[model samples]
Target: MSRSFVKMNGLGNDFVVVEARGAPFRPTPEEVRAIADRESGIGCDQLIAIEPTANADAFMRIWNADGSEVSACGNATRCVGWLLMQAKGDGRATIETLAGLLTTWAAGPRAVTVDMGAPGLGWRDIPMAEDMDTRGVELQVGPIDAPHLHTPGCVSMGNPHVVFFVANAELAPVREVGPMIEHHLLFPEGVNVGFCEVREPDRIRLRVWERGAGETKACGTGACAAVVAASRRGLAKRRATVTLDGGDLKIDWREDDGHVLMSGPVAVEFTGVLP
Candidate 1:
C-alpha cells in the first residue's frame, strides 16, 4: 500500500513526515535507510511518524537518516507542531515523544515556538560512562600538554549532547573530530557534537554533527543545548540568538521555568506518496 508523506524543513534540516494516526507506520531499519537515501529515494535528515496519542495531540516517532530510532528532535518537533496547528486551525499544539511532552505555539507566519523541557545536567542524566562535571568534561583531542579541544559541556536535551567552545565555529574540526567524540567511551549512548562560537552575550554561532545524521544545516535541540552550555560556562547569557549554517534560532533557557524554548521557522518543501 502507498502512503502519503510530507517533506518539511526547519532551517534546512529536512524531514519526511508521515501521518500514521489512523494506521501504524513502522518501517524497518533497511527501509528507513532506503527512503532517506538522497540518490534514489525521498531524502531527509530524519523520518517522522505522527502517531495517535491519548495524552497529547500526537506522538512523534523519529528515526535518523542512518535508520537509528532516536528519542527527540527539536526541529522536527516545530515542523510537526505547525502541521497539527494548521490542521486544527489553532495556535497551540502538544506533542509527545520518548523525551517527554512538548508544548508548541505559533510564533508568527511559518514560525513556531517549542518548549523543549528542562535539560538534564547530572552525569547520570547524560548517562556518561563515569562521574564527571557536566559543565566541563575532561576530554582532550590533541597532545597531552596542549590539546586542541578540551573540556566540553555536556547536556541532555532529550538526547545527549556535548558543546565545545571554539574561537570560530567555521574553523572547528567538525568532520574530523565529531565522529570520534560521538562514539567515545565517555558517551556510551553516542552523542551529538556541537561547535559553538560566542559572538556576544546574547548571540552565538554554531555548527553541529548529529549522532546518526552527520552534519546538518541546523539542529534545534543543539541550539538550545549550546545556549545552556554557554550560560553554564559564563560565555553567554541564558537567552541568545543562535546562528546556524542555514539560519538563526532564538533559544531561551528560562530562569523561572527552567525549560528551554526554541523558536524557528518551518517550511514545507513538497508532498508525495511513498511506494
Candidate 2:
C-alpha cells in the first residue's frame, strides 16, 4: 500500500516523515536505503516514522540514509514538533524517542525550540571502549609531531559525539577525518564527529559528520553538542549561536535546569506518496 509522507528540513538537514499512527509502517533496511537514495527515490538525510504513543504526542523512529536505526535526531524532532503543533493548533508538543522524552514549542514563525535534555559527560555515557576523560579524550589525527585535530571533547546528547576545537571550520577535513574517527575503535558504537570553530563566546561555526548519514548540511544535536563541548572546555559560554553550513541555530545550555534548548527554523520541502 502507498503511504503519504512529508518532506521537511531544519536548516538544510532534511527528512522523509512518515506518520504511522493509525497503522504500522515498518520498512525493511533496503526500503529505507531506497527511500533515502537521492538519485532514484525520495531522498532525505533520515527517514522518520511517527507512531502512536501513550506518554507523548508521538514516538519518533529514526533511520539514517544508510539504513541504520538510531536513537535520536534533534532536527527531525523539531520538524515533527512543528507538524504536531500545527495539527493541534497549539505551540507546544511532546515527542518520545529512544533517547528520552523531548518537550518542544513554537519559538517563532516556522521556528521551534526543543529541550534536548541534559548532556551526558561521563566516559560510560559516551560509552567509550574504556574509561577516559570525556572533557578531552585521547584522540588525535594527522602526524603526531603536527596533529591536525587532537584532544577532542566527548559527550552524548542522546548519542555519542566527539568535538574537535579547530581554528577554522572550513579548513577542517570533514570527509577524510570524520569517517576515520567515526569508525575509530575507541568509540565502539560509532560516533558523530564535529569540527567546531569558536568565533566568540556567544558564536560558533560548526561542521558535522553524522555516524551513518555522512556530512549533512546541518545537524541539530550536533549543534547542541558543540555548544556543550565548547562550554565544558571553557572555550564558549553556556549559550551560543551555532552557525552551520545551511543556517544558524540558537543553543542554550540552561544553567538552572541543566537542559539544552535548541531553537531553529523548519521548512516543509514537499509532500508525496511513497511508491
- Cα lDDT listed for each candidate: 0.97, 0.96
Q: Per-residue lDDT for 54-166 in model 1, tens only?
A: 99999999999999999999999999999999999999999999999999999999999999999999999987999999999999899999999999999999999999999
What does the lDDT read for residue 95 in candidate 2?
Answer: 98
Regions of model 1 farther than 4 Å from truth: none
TM-scores for all candidates?
0.99, 0.99
Top candidate (lDDT): 1
**Candidate 2 lDDT, tens digit per residue, 93-124?**
99999999999999998999999999999999
What local lDDT score does residue 33 receive in model 2, on the 0 to 100 scale?
97
Q: Which residue pairs show backbone clashes in model 1? A: none
